[model samples]
Target: MRQILLFAALAAVLALLLVSCGGTKDKPVPTEEDAPGKAAYHKISAEEAYEMMISQEIVVVDVRTREEYDGGHIENAVLVPNESIGSEMPETLPDKEATLLIYCRSGRRSKDAAQKLLALGYQSVYDFGGVIDWPYELVKEG
Candidate 1:
């Protein structure tokens, strides 16, 4: 009788655990790829990104507002506001596997934009904060 009670209790506990975990028999365990981390979305210095810009082929994305970008922006940086990263990627940038160097007016917008870009299937996205910290040349629109 004691052995029967022990078996029943163990079975009950096992059933509870399975039900608590969504009750799915074939569900795989979640991994970091299921949710990206900060390191995956690298936050490098402006100088680092600048060196890449000069030395290698990289796409620089500015996540600031149009007015902010129009004020002054790093040369060769394209405007793709954080709010504009919709379900579809910008037509100007269609390569999901491209190495993207992203920035904004400050660090906040760039971080948000980088995550969104990653979620949208951008494989390599780097958030280098704002151009305000960039100790380099800036281009003003006419």
Candidate 2:
């Protein structure tokens, strides 16, 4: 009977330890974080993206390959390949607060990059469709 009681006490202590070390469940996930400083996902059209670019200091991100980017892209968009974006913040996008305008060959990769950026806690991510749909003049890297 004494041994059983001791085993029960040990089991209780172990359970308490597990609960303490399991981490908190209240913390928001990257994409769901919407507090003042936290990031949120926002979708915008190509025209709206252009307007924001002209009116604001937004960073245009081309989530395409170097070859794809050299072919043609927005005036000053930086290259951050979709495959490169993972758990870590991208090198080209240092400011998590900067308004990120994402684009790719078509609408598909842009959406993917946007989701990844959101998951990485990047605020104000705007996906502007594809370069093929962009009405503005595209500049090819010389």
Q: Give the TM-score of each candidate.
A: 0.72, 0.73
Question: Which tens-of-lDDT digit does each residue in 1-142 have in candidate 2?
Answer: 9999999999999889878776466464545355677666677888999999999999999998999999989999999999999999988899988889999988899999999998888878989878888998999989
Off by over 4 Å in 1: 1-39
Residue 66, model 2: lDDT of: 99
The sequence of per-residue lDDT tens digits that candidate 1 reaches over residues 104-134 is: 9779999998988887888889999988798
Global lDDT of each candidate: 0.87, 0.88
- lDDT top scorer: 2
List the pairs of residues colliding in candidate 2. Answer: none
**Model 1 clash number:** 0
- Model 1, residue 59: distance off in Å is 0.7
Relative to the unseen true structure, what is the C-alpha lDDT of residue 5 in candidate 1, on a scale of 0 to 100?
A: 100
Candidate 2, residue 66: Cα displacement in angstroms equals: 0.8
